[model samples]
Target: MLQHSAILGGGMGGMLAAFALAPHAEAVTVVEQDAFAGEPVPRRGAPQARHTHALVSGGARAMEALVPGVLAELAAAGAQHINLPGRYLGLASRGWFPRYAGRQFILGCSRELLESTLRGRLRELPNVTVLGRTEVVGLQGSPAGITGVRTGSAPLTAELVVDATGRRSRAPRWLTELGFPPVRESIVDPGIFYATRVFRAPVDAGPEFPAVTLQSSPRREPGVRRNGTLLPIEDGLWMITLSGGPGSRPGTDAEGFRAFAALLPHPVLAELIEAATPVGTPFGFRADANRRRHFERLRPCPNGFVALGDAYATFNPVYGHGMSAAALSALALRTEFERRRKPGTLRLQRAVAGAAANAWDMATGQDARYPGTAGPGPGRFDGIIDRLGDWISASSGRSRLVTDIRADIFALTAPPSRMRSPRVLWQAVRGGDNGPALPDPPFTAAERRVLGVRPR
Candidate 1:
């Protein structure tokens, strides 16, 4: 049994890992490279914090379980809980998704606010301590078992160690130096670029305002593909993000950003923000590849060591699955630890990897089909799955049953297999009476009035 544990990184994943291990270990220490002891501001370590972030329902439930009342706390701090299918004015690959009162929802807020809230809650644990400004240099033991970690010339011995250091993790090099074979990695890059800007919401805009999205279709050809989203965040502010794949990369400049928004399938996003006040210059990010480290496949897996979060796998941020996947992995770790009499490190690591599998498939499966995507394309089986997925996506726009099932799958509330069930499959085959697709975004009059924008 492990008595002491150390987790690298202090973001949402690492903090949640600490929360999961706190009950089992006598001491849980988090080694973070950046100083996060102050207010909710963008840190150098997390540059992506400036962009938009959402906590899907699955992640919200895991977070609430890990730190009871976290969702309520976030809501109190101005995070908006927009119900899925009901409060979302979404444009799918086929057409607009109808608004129906649904059970699933997601939390919208700035990444900085989300991290700061988790960090604050973790601080209340008696046995947990976050060592900000500390960096982990290497491992202390051989490939057989990691006994501790090194911080420059200093060393902190631990019974267990977790790597939650995001995509830039050095675990591969550390494992190699420790005489372990290199872990296999899979990278699928779609050349997706994001240009994000924050705008002051209209005075009437509030929590009741529906979130809007215009998505690009991978099935379309002979044209640049792009997508846009407008989410209402804290303090009556709208965080708008424009994404382009390959040839249609969105620009970082203000003019280019506006142009990209204008070019989306619908002009609602641009029209809504035309008169709104810009918070700052638009920012751009391009490291949106889906990368996975196959640690579970390694032979003679090292004991007392495991990788979680982006260290294990990183998905495209456009899907908004990263944080939720991390939280789910943390929950898996906690469950394995509590259930087993003597939790083997390899077993726990595999469980964590299993938690990330569905998300990895959901993200990479979609990105691999986009034009100009690099890395090993999908296999024959994957190609078949992709085709089915495309059919489902197109059918979802027309069928409420398909849309609800998709919402559940995407929110991580249910397994992907649910879509393959007989009832859903039959629905997809028979197809429901969806009527004509909405010519414009299905924004309610009340929502339009709140945003101070007229219906198109």
Candidate 2:
């Protein structure tokens, strides 16, 4: 039986892991390197927090069920609730997609605020302890089993160690230190880079603005690379992110960013930021890749430990799969923990890693669609998936059949198989007119002035 659990990070995955274990273990401690204080400010500890982060409805439900009152707390703290299909306006390589009502929704807020709220609730649990300012440097025990984690400042022993250390995790090295071979790994990197800036909202169109995205059209005659997004976060602010991968890179300067946004398929991103009050300098981040460790395939796995979130797999942040995958992983952990209550069982460890397979496949599978996506080429089935995704994107603008397929895909509620349904096939073949090409988003007259678009 597991008497205690030690989590080796304080990010979303780490925090969720603590929550999952708190109910099963006699005690749970989260060893975090940074101190959580002040009004949820960004820290160097979480680089992605500085970028735009949102919770899909699937993740939101999982988190709310794991950490009580999370949704209420987030809403009270200024997170915007957005209906997924009905409220989102996106420009894809094919064309603009018509917004349709769907069963799922998304919550938009700064990553810091979401973490701080969850941290606060978690700290209140009697069996959980937040070991603030504590850095975990290594693992304790042999490859047969992990007894505990050895930290930089202080070494603590526990029955189980959970690594939720995000992308820069030392788990692999630590495993190697214990005599285990390198975990089976896969990498599909598009070599994406990001430049983002926060601006005060020019208009009170919070709910109406509809999170706008202009996606890259790589499958076109001449492959192209570029994408832009405008997300409405907390405090009457909007976060605009411009990204390019491989040979394409967004500029670091403010004027350059604005100019780049202006060139995207739609003028929404540039228009939204043109006249808005700039609140912060543009932040840049690179090395965003899709990598995964297939721990489930190992013949003999270490006991008393498992890696989740970015530590286990990292998706290209451009797709916004990080948090959703983390939530799914946490649920997987809970399922495995419930299956085998024994703490130091290698069987249980293997099972936990096995549970993350679906999420890992989902993230890397689609990231492979980008042109010049550097990595191993996909198998025949993967090629079909990519082409079908493009087909659905082209047909979704007009056909309700494609709309259902799209809603299922984007909502993260269904597997890729949803696109193959006979209903979708019939509609794609018969409904030749996939509706008229979508127009520019419903921007107010003021928004037109901001982008300097002449009256049409």
Candidate 3:
């Protein structure tokens, strides 16, 4: 029997869900409320799309497989490709992270470009149909099972309903309406605020000029909290953002934005902005914190229903892991669809959630280090691991091994256990041979000159 699938939301998750299920589902429909023009225009559904987002190698791989020529299309459309450590300069709680030979890379582009491309390509899939300007009001099913979704003035029936409606998902409410209890949820809000400005690229250094990042140090500057990042996107444009957490917050005004970046652990962002020509007004976004819904643990999940992407979980955007996590979640669902031809299978749900759990635990566990981070605080074990992670990344300025392990974790390609490998743990505990320490992220001589910083 052919099964019809209804996907709520049409962003990355919704589109990916449609891509994953289209092969198995008899018909795939994506219900999106925002107007989509088959081109990347700002939408109300994804406010955070204005900030810096990276398509990590792990997620990139999944996206490529799901939609052939996606990477090529993005590259053709002006996506910047960066390799970890090599093309990424990072600051940790300790100090500068050493640039190492990278195995994987990240695609840096506008959220608009990413979504536009994904939506455009998915439209070509014969089995996938996008229902724009439509909202999912509720679910049509019982507490034990989901049968379909209820849109305004329309009851769309489907054998399976996948909720990819992002952080604002009404799945819990819809389920409750169907006589089911609320799904258990966890939230950790460090009160993060982001302000981003786009500027014409300072210079064309190709890949030599890496992505610049000044990470927030939770323990070092106890009372002061500020961080900034400068990412090169397509065309000659740079997406610069200043982020503040907990007590500290980035400003909405342009002058204050530069001042905020200037006060970061480094002045690179401030310097760069001062030299580059601003393209437009700065964009800002603020959300409570990292939150995830535990739909897997529910006693009964309908056979034909599944949840993917932000609908299942959302992490702090500061980490830049949300896209990667969504890609991985989509892959899990795709893998299940390939193996199991039927919907509502417990094994499939468990497998997909279990796969998603790794990304959730790593993101939330590390974020818990913040003083007032929302979810569970780090216990003794978590604390130990956190300290070790800090030590390795901090000391990575001197050790290549530490840099490699750190890059792998950041890219979402390697599990958290990679850091605890006997090989890495041994050197981590003993502190390996020291090399030329990078006091701070190295900016090219030209970049420094452009930013008005004297070359080192």
Give all candidates' CA lDDT scores: 0.83, 0.75, 0.78
Tell me the deviation in Å of residue 364 in model 1: 0.8
Predicted structure 1: lDDT: 0.83
lDDT by residue (298-320, candidate 3, tens digit) is 66665566777888888877778
Candidate 2 worst ten-residue window by lDDT: 447-456
Per-residue lDDT over 247-352 for candidate 2, one digit per residue giving the tens place of the 0 to 100 score: 7778778888888787776777877776577787998889557888766555467777778888878878776767877877787677677877663455545554
Model 1 root-mean-square deviation: 2.2
Error of 1 at 146 (Å): 0.2
Clashing pairs in 2: 398-434
Question: Which candidate achieves the best TM-score against the true structure?
Answer: 1
Question: What TM-score would you give candidate 2 relative to the actual structure?
Answer: 0.92
Q: Per-prediction TM-score, please?
A: 0.95, 0.92, 0.94
